[model samples]
Target: MRRFLYAENGAVSVYLILIIVPIFLFQAVLIDFARIKAAEKESESAVQAASRSVMSSFDSDLQKRGLYGMVLSQENSEQLFSEVFAKNLSSGVTANAFHFIDTKAVDGGMRVTPVYALASHAIFEGQLLEDMKLKGPIEFSLEIADKFQKSGVKAPFQMGSQFAKNAAEVEKLIEQREDALDEAWHSTEVMYARITTFHLYYQKRISDLDAMANRIGLHTIDELRIEINQVKDQLQSLSNAIHNMDLSMSSMMTASPQSIQAALSARSNLEQQYSTLSQKLNDLEALVQLIIQYTALIVSTKLEVAVNERDILQLQQSIEPVLRLAKQKNDDIRAKLTAIGGSSTSTTSDSQGVNDVFQHVSLIGDNYFYDYQISVASIASLFTAFHLKIESIALYTAANTNQANAANDAYWTLVNDFYSKKSSIEKARMDANDGTKAKKQTERNKIQAVLDKAKQAIGGCSFIQSQSNDEALYNKLQGDTSNLESANVQGFYQKYRQVNAQDVLIGNDVAYDLDKAESTSLRAMDILGVITQASEMLRDELYVNEYALTKFNYRTYGLEKDRSGQAKLSNELVDPGSHQLANQEAEYLLYGFSSCAANISSAYAEMFSLRLAIRTVENLLDPEKELLNVGSPLLVLLVAAAQGAVEAFADMNALVKGESVELSSKLSAAILKLTYKDYLRLFLMLHSDNTKLMARMQALIELETGKDLTQAAAYIQTNATSEIRLWFIPQMMKLFNGSDLLGCKVVGTQCQFNRTAIVAY
Candidate 1:
């Protein structure tokens, strides 16, 4: 004991043990805390990931099918959540994996919340938490909800050669659509013309028949009897002639040879004269028979093929214009019979955050952002150090492109569905009354039944003459009142009215759905506009870059006047590397621009349609000039009807195939430099000549809206000159029309109009 109390060497060891023991205890507590936190984070992340997966799937299903088949159903909820959870979460702290309990429906979608217990064994002086009587595991409940209103994009345009192939295919599809529409337009015009001709022919025949009827008094016995009596009176007057003829007969028997021959000739002349009088009566009878023939033909063809016309001519004068102006539609039966005419052949978005958003540039866009020196090599060596940056931009642009494509799909799908439904409805409506005979048949059956009963009760109604007016109708109605009362005739008609009201509701739903789908597409225009504008900016950038390279070459080689205004080298010589580098930079920039342009054009057309081009072309035309029924002067209307078919076919190839036989883009690019003024002039001229924009302009010069194409062109020139211009900054073009001026920039450039692009598609 005395030695231990004096042991000073062991004192340092005791203090070291106390310090090391506390440090280890603290370290163990921290490790336990970290493990628990990690488990919690894993649970939360799993919930989020599962929710996102469901939402994406829901949207995909919504687009592919309708709402009914979406995976949001209860049957799929658990399986879907489990799949995502497996991918996103791990059981590092716990022995058990997370499982989905249930999914609850939210406002637009469903909520997926999963619960799991995290088993974390703690170290407390080398003993497990279970042995220590502490909690063995912590339960974690995680919830995530999907938002459907936030529409996401899916279909993205591919890069490189894939883009070109896709664009060609879409272009071919558009051409097929245009050709079909135009062919129908021509056929419709011809059909209308034929109908009109038939109407006129029958109308003239009616006029001739009317004159004959009036002269002969058809449908009247008194006139024919009166004519017969007049002929008898003429016969009575000719009695003296008859007696003379009898005396001639006796003379013929006893006369000399010359006298007898003369008497015989006179007798023959009298016989011929009598025969001519008999022929007049037969002619009047034939005229009456012809009137009956016209009436019978009208009945047989069921008022379709009318003679001295009613049905065909009547429709031609009134509804012909309505039929003419309908948007070109597919007539499967007729189109199919047209020998199934020819077939189909085919043939990104830009990221704004990429630090450049130049819609266009002349000298330089004010918005252009390039590092002056510090990171200048970044853009220069785009393929190397900046490859990831380019890839990122491509990805982001692709997402926006997908959004744009998705937005328009719903609209076009709705439109196609609407038309298909409308066609079906029309067929149903046409058969609503079963050729207008069902009502007549019903009324006839009622009348016949009543007449039978009347005959049984009292007798007499053997004659059945056609009623002339309302008196017969009133009498029949009075007679059938008892039957009508028993049958609830008024109530039966009221049921039809109720049915009609239901149809009206259906109509309202159709219109609302169509408008909603279109609005949805329009909402994404801003996003797509960014992508489109970015694509456009690429072209300008390429031009400027190539232009700059040439200027650099000029200065390096000591040109007399270089645009860059740099001091020329003393010797007219430049290094081979510098020259080669400049050429490479220019070419690469061009390659980039062309690829982006092609991809943007393809995606726009693929997601939506190029039929928009057709609509835009049709819109520019005037109503009166295009439609046969609406022309001002009657003479113009007549002349228009005669040439309606020709007019319909005039600009069809241009509208569909995009320009004339030559590609509009190449031609417009080659020799077509359109200033704003020239653009306006060409637009007016093309639209007026090709469509009906200024059909009556020659006569209506006083109206602001209606003036000669020349005047409109001049005014536009004057205005452009007066305004302060943004020369380098190309303003957004007016879609399909304006894009046409840009030519090859757009997928469908209509060169047929021989006009510049008036708008972007």
Candidate 2:
């Protein structure tokens, strides 16, 4: 060994050979390791990228589903998985496949099942596996086989196995995602159903309320109308009675002496009758006032009640609890309906059917209930008041009738008395006239005196009776006459005269007595006139009272009518409230539907993301493993070693042989310092110098001379003091004059730099 070592012939060459060979081997190993590491890193990065893409896809799907506000469905989950698969597979990774299985096993068998699959073109029998996987016999197995076989490759390079494992994991994730999606969809369905039910209930209630209100209103108006008619009839009757009294007065004034006393007695009775009639009329007026007050009270109360009912209905319909429940039901229904393919047409039809049925029932019941109540109350109150008013009126009528009867009796009594008195006086006067001349004169004087006394007594009695009648009539007629010349008044006088007065007496003394009687009759006629006036006044007062009562009745009627209107309005509002409820229900249903859609979308996205992640891991693990198997480790390592050595040598050489580096730095600094006018010259010089230096440095750095100077230069540079100490030189130049070095040139021993100066001025 010593001889061999001591041998000088090829010792240097041999030593050089030994050292170089070992160094080469070491470099080869490093390069081989680096290449393997790089491949592995690349694969990992691709897998990670794919996983991230999958996650993003899932997240996007979830967002589309509006998972926060709604629910998810199965369809959404499937679509999302498919999309993720497409995106992930498109990446450089190997073939990817997606599958799902029910977590709940049937008959104790595996519930897991293959749902979807994707494979690379390089992979053979891809369809066979895909089809087999769907057959349900292949129990939850995920396999990713590369086009190249795993055999005949280096150790620790089972790419296919790794990919298969990754596939399995991905499939598992997809299954989990699918399960989540199902749960979300179920929840959405439940919520939808609740909301729908709530809406329907609200509408039904509103409809019922509306019907009741309308019926009440109609009843109120009818009652008012009836009252108004009754008042009008009463008024007409009073008017007719006044007209007849006027004629009775006119006839009394034209009677003869014999009738005068009878007329006076009749006048006295008539005056008494007038007083009674007036009192009866007053009583009727009082009764009417009482009815009016009561009617007003009832009307006001009914109106208030109607208003209250409307408010109560509104409150019931708008309650939050009701709304919430309805919304929930709506959501539930929507979900179920969607699942069952219940389109909008079917739902709308069903809803309409429910509404029609409920409306028919509710409206009938409500109408009946309200109408019955209103009708009963109105009829009872109105009839009772009417009965009372009529009874009072009838009593007044009876009293007036009695008074009239008394007046008739008195009139006839006075006529009989007047006839009797006239017969006696006439006999006495004849007897006196037949006596002696002295006796005849005395008897004539006595007869004349008796005649004068009789006339005076008749006159006084008629005057007193007429005056009394006139006073009574005046009291009755105080405020009744409208024009005192109506057709009613004229007709009244004609009828009374035809019924009560015509003829009484005729003679000289009789004519004189007739004239006196006529005067008394005129007075009595005037008294009758007063009585007629009183009757007219009473009639007018009754009419006025009737008018007042009618107005009160009308006002009461109006109140009732208004109450009915309000009730109707309240009912009308119920329909709107029902509609509002329906609308709310619809909104709830829509919300449910949206939630379901959102959940579906979210599920899809999650599935897609899981599939994508699986595919990414599979691709990275599979293809890279194949590549590693195919390539020879030793040879790959040798090549990498050579390249690294060459690069290191080149970098060292470039640093050592680089000429004008210091000069270039100086030129750069000079260029930086240049003013705008000098920048062009410096830029041109630097440009040329930089170009030449770069070319030379490039060749040296490449180590074409086969030297190692890179390490030495790196060490020196690392340890060396910084010659270019102004770290802010560029900034300073930019600040002062805005100049940057563009190029550098070497000329003999000097270097020129070119710079471009940005000048504001």
Candidate 3:
């Protein structure tokens, strides 16, 4: 040892060898360490990105295929797995391979095998061993026979043969699995396409059905209008007949000469006939007015009913397909629900990690299934309620039709009786001549006796006895007889002569006498002609007045204006100078005018009353019209609302099925956009930061995010923690006041990572 150390030349060689060898070894170690670290980091980043990408792609694909809520799409599953593998193995060490091994096999046997591979390097070099063996159930052993230096130590590497075997086996399994998944995916795509087609077809059917219903309703309304118009024409004809009868009666009254005893007796007989004809004409006029008013009311009411019924039916039908889809989606979501709770497990421990996996799957199932079920149930319930309401309306409509028919029958019968009586009286008068005057006088006397007996019988009643003798019985009798005498003379001398005249004079002196005599007839007939003329003049007036009242029976579109006209007329008659009074005084007398108006106002009051009764009957027959307008734009809105709701439900279900929540809120926002207009006005009102409302919003926000506001305040004091937490939560809260965030809950608040309030302003 002393001799070796003392050799000067050899000592220099030993020092150089020690320094150079150690430095070279250290440099190699450093290089290898850096390479390994870089590779590890790259692999980890790639894997993380790949996993996230896989989830994103899976969710998107699932939604497109309509499989997220109910069932997994085989195509989407395969595509997602492929995406993850492609992203992970596309970089770093050559020949990197990846595969998803189904731990749960149908045969109850676990198969740990590669399902995908990417080879960029020769397989014989053992480059695929690490990734390939990672897919196995246990640690795979490899023998490396080649010399390799690592960490300053030389080791024999001989894992080439084993790696090659593993690679070959993995490649073979992957190819088989890829084929199977591709086939399954293709089949699933076909199924989904069929489902979509069916859904669209059904939706079209529903739309067509709604359109048909609307057309039916419109047709019914048209039919009702026609019927009403026919009734109005009949009433108008009757009114004209009454007016002619009144004129004939007046002429008959005037035809008798005053001096001769026989002529006086003839005059008396004519007066009786005139009185009877005038009364009959009055009755006929009343009946015609009633029919006109009632028809108008019925037409209006039926139109309203048909509109309502059609709207309800359309709405119900529109939602049927949507409801069915929702139900099916809900069932799928329920199946996914079992995975929901499992997702809550902590990922810190291996056991917790496994729990998370199970929970994730279960949560996905539960959320999708529940959403679908709830949506379906809600829509179904709404449609069911709507249907029930429509049925009830139908029943009411049938009842109203029966009532209208009965009332019409009664009215027409009265009209027929009046017409028959008038015809008989006219025929009897025409048959009478100079030779039969005495006989006719005797017949007239008998009829007068019967009339006097009727008056006596009416007078015996206590109600008649209570009236003042001078003011009631004597006045009534005198007025009635005087009117009869005038009507008889006018009818006999002027109208009868004119009708029988060989030379008909349009404006001769003879015709003037006839006209003058008619002017002196019964007060009611004279008043009727004046009322008719006045009504014609004021038919366009808006306010009810004496003029309007006289024209009340006039109809333009089956709507009653007579009552309104009479009410106005009465108001005017009581206070012609009321226009100069203050609003208060005018209003005070309004009630008095209304009461007195009924007695002296035009026949319009009765017409209006009859119209109201008919309207009531129509409403009873078709109640739906009262609910909503079928032809209005609201029907389209209802259909759109239902469609939007269904889409939202489907979106939510998809998210739940895939355990994906990132875009769930976005889907909910889309849904809100569709229906937001309905509540926009109300939303604006509630957006004010009123004391009561602000407090409620703040409390709700705190409860939802599970973050104590007090703690957030304290954390804000620290710079580091503040920076992290402030990035999203505070900005999000600020941009959206509480109400806006509330809308997010529709898609599940948990997915947002924080419960946010929705500001509606």
Off by over 4 Å in 3: 1-269, 292-303, 325-329, 342-761
Q: Which tens-of-lDDT digit does each residue in 1-761 have in candidate 1? A: 99888989878889999999888765754443343344344544555556555445532211211111122444465457556654554432243644221111112222242211010001111111122123211110000000101111111111111222322332233334334434433443443445445435434433443454455443444565567567656655555576697786785676688887777787677666666655765665565565466345334422333231333233233333333222222222223223211211111222111101111101111121121111222212221212222222211233533443343233334334433544454455335324323433443344334323322322111111222332222222122233565553322112222322322011001010111222212222222222212222222222222222222221012222223655324221223123322211111111111122222222222112111222211221222332222111112212212222122223322222122221112112232211111112222221122101111111111111121122111000000000011112122221323542332111121111111111100
TM-score, one value per model: 0.19, 0.13, 0.16
In the range 1-761, model 3's lDDT, one tens digit per residue, is 99776768677788899999888766754443343334334334443443344334322221221111112233443345334433443232233444221011011111111111111011101212332233321111111001011111110001111112222232233333333333333332333343344334433433443333433333344454555565556556655655665565566665655434554455466556556555655554554454444445335444543454354344334434443444444344344333333432322222222122222211113453344334333433433333333233332234533443333233234334433553454344334322233442443344334323323322221321122332222221112234555543221112212322323111111110111111111111122222112212221111112111111111111221233443223221223212211111111111111111221121122211112222222221222332222211112112222222233334323321222222122111221211111111111121211221212212222222222222121000000000001112333233343454322111111112121111100
Error of 3 at 314 (Å): 2.1
Whole-model lDDT, model 1: 0.28
Worst 10 residues of 1 by lDDT: 714-723
Model 2 residue 46 CA deviation (Å) reads 48
lDDT of 3 at 451: 29
lDDT agreement with native, every candidate: 0.28, 0.27, 0.28
Report the error of model 1 at residue 500, Å.
69
| Location of the lowest summed lDDT over 10 successive residues in candidate 2 | 714-723
The alpha-carbon RMSD values of the candidates against the true structure, listed in the order shown, are 42.6, 57.3, 49.1
Better of 1 and 2 by TM-score: 1
